[model samples]
Target: MKSNRGRRRDMQIAADNGDRLSKLPNDLLLNILERVGTLDAVRTCILSRQMLKLPTMLSQIVIDLSLRDLVRMNGVVADVTDKILSARSPQITIHKLKVKFLLSPSRCLSIGKSVARAMATQKLDAAEFEILTPRDFQNCTEAYLLLFAAQLNNFLHACPDAFAGLTRLHLQNMRFAELDITNILITCKRLESLCFVECDAGICSVLNVEHARLVEFTIAFGEFKTVELSYLPKLQRMTYNYWPCDDNPLVLGFVPQLSELNLTNAGLSDKTLELSQLLANVHTVRDLYLNFHSEKIWVRPECSWVLAPVLAQLRTVNLDNLPEECDFAWTMFFLEAAQCLEELCFTVWDHKCCRESQKSFSKKTDVKWEPSSIHFKHKNLCKLTIYGFQSDKNFTSYIRRTMKTAVNIQEISLHDRKVCKICAEKFPQMEARPSSYPRTDEEKDSLRKKIAAKPTMVASPAMIHFPS
Candidate 1:
């Protein structure tokens, strides 16, 4: 019921005092916006003119555009991205910039320009660029090759000095040769972690990664003849997954601090590729993970042939899909050498093919698992776990053998495949049956009952666990 003039004056005073967030400085406002989210902060532009530029103050910018989005937004995504990067204040540094887009020749230029501009102005802690092409690019002929080549060339060349301040960088689907990678590594002097996935390394016969400050590195799905990892004193973690290395051994040198190593699908099925020389320089590694093909021996289990350096400090070891019938040569070798091993895990793949494959392995017949040997005492091994356990006689015997020697063993856990969510989710076809492949439920139940009927063979005070 106040007069109109009085109401106008009150409104003007409120505007002068500023809105709820108007009292905060630009940095504090940006911090609030960052915590609230970029989308919400952008919406605040309607509330006041000052907030129209709030999104540019964000330290982390993630732009993801796909084919579906390109149709609806009609390529406004790139323009908006450029504008956001351009508007960002030079004083405010970007911590992370992750951009994922479907690759196109025109879009590649825009992306390269935006990324280069952003990197030029800000000190990025981490940057990830993912160029995903359509799965059916083979049908497109020369267009596919042209698009990929243009994108890769423009991206790498455009940002020569961009990665100097970056701590972490991830590149996906990039086709770079040895010289290209060396240039990137040289420019990224402070890079701590680097990852390449599905990258084309076909042009390079030998790639040398010698980074002084690099701490962690990963390469997957690459066709490299030889990869030399040298002079990386601070490297702590390394992963080489599905490496189609073309029968070339990895050359390792001067990585004194490398601790954790994962080698999965290493294509080492051939007997000639010995692991001893490959792991000779990595004696300092503590955690090791190896996933070998079911049909082949990634590492030969011949006791007479020394295959690896003794890892005295190895605390954790994880193996996948080990042949159940084979002699525990690898297991025995690790246990004998790794005096400080605290945990051991085996992911058993319970399938009919694995059983059939085990029968063909001739080494199992010659080698005998004699747990009574005086060298079987392992006092440091505390926890042992087996996933996808079918409670087969061979596996149970192996477990019983371990329990007898591990005097200080704390726990022995055997997880059934039927109850394992990961196994069921990964192999839905296998989930139709309860136990071992090609066996009936009644037969499996009988086998389980018979196994359970036996007296618990645990000698030590170790806790024995089985799935309910």
Candidate 2:
């Protein structure tokens, strides 16, 4: 239907576009493919002849079942993994490799042997295996936990080469014996990161770890009574979830390079944890995160002199999950001890789904404490971040006090309550206090003025922000 001139112009425009994408640099195009994931990237190769070679040139491969069509995905892990790995050219060295699959002996053996073959042929920078239990965690029984651990032990024995090359490993819903966990750590000599979800040695057994090359470790919802970081020289970051211990959940050992630590627990029967004793061995920590899980606060507030020795090097602190109505002034104890702290963040929310009553969770109350180091002033604190911030005195007075203490404070970011989609959907009829986050410039200015009008002390001038 078009004329000769029109036909020529259309073809010329298409040519100028260089087949729409074929002219892009190899690295840029590979990055786009990598971000979209390996399986999706392979399908994209059909778009153009130029992209067909991209799959063979990939340096990273990740096959996460959660990212795929998860319906009935339990049994096809072996076939999918073999197809992807077999298609790749062995000459291209993989920089990162991750495969998450369910616990099926035959399928798992096939996956491990395939990875072992790949490791023998090419240089794999890092490899990981995320093994999922046969059923959901809530449906797991004691006998099932023991059976899964034994099967994994046999799997490790069958493919020693693949286990040796792995740099990261994640296991879930397997309860190993005291010696089983120690043996796995020894076999995986090059491991740098390890994660365990609802897996433990026992309910009240002591677990000792001795890894030379391990750098980052995480354990969530484990029943171990006391975990000893016996000897880990290169360890830097550690995340520990709920524990049933009465004292400190971790026993710090020879970890000189440990810099960041995150601890989260729905308080275990109101047991108070003292940082001085728990962090006595590791003093180089620069960042600390503690989540109280919207229940009773478990940390015992200490005086500046008592906690200063260990908290002296701390630069940032995050105190999360405080009940919205409780007094936030109790958090000032960190600024009192960590004289070098540069940033402090807090999140105050009463999770509706976690609540037993409609009003609030403050019935259990927060850790009762008062300021002990009034004369001390923090010169390095530059940022204050608060979620679920309101214009009431509970928050305003706390801000005014912190401003007076943190003489060099530069910014205050106030945000609304973090939305929990699961809670909203599960408890649709539950009531929550209306959010008071400022929606306009006038409201933000008014709240800033109210907190800044301090007469008792010369508060440092700082910019206040209401994050939208």
Task: List TM-scores for all candidates, in order.
Answer: 0.72, 0.90
| Candidate 2 residue lDDT tens string, 1-468 | 999999999999987785666668888888888987677887777678888878767788887877244336645667766766777787788999988888888888999988988888877899999988776678899888888989999999999899899999999888897689988998899999999998998788788989999999999987888989999999999999888788657998999999999998877475788898999887899999998777767788888788898998999999888877667777888998898999999999877676544544446565567777567688999999998887777888888888888888989888888888878887777677887777888888878877887776465334888876
Error of 2 at 437 (Å): 3.8
Report the CA-based lDDT of candidate 1 relative to the real structure. Answer: 0.65
Q: Which pairs in model 2 have colliding backbones?
A: none
* Per-residue alpha-carbon lDDT of candidate 1 for residues 63-172, written as tens digits (9 for 90 to 100): 65555664464256566667788888888878877666555657656766777777776766677665565543334344444455456556556655545555677665
lDDT of 2: 0.83
Residue ranges of candidate 1 with Cα displaced over 4 Å: 1-54, 64-77, 90-93, 103-106, 115-120, 134-150, 174-178, 266-268, 302-309, 323-329, 350-373, 418-462
Candidate 1 has which clashing residue pairs, if any?
none
RMSD of each: 7.6, 3.5
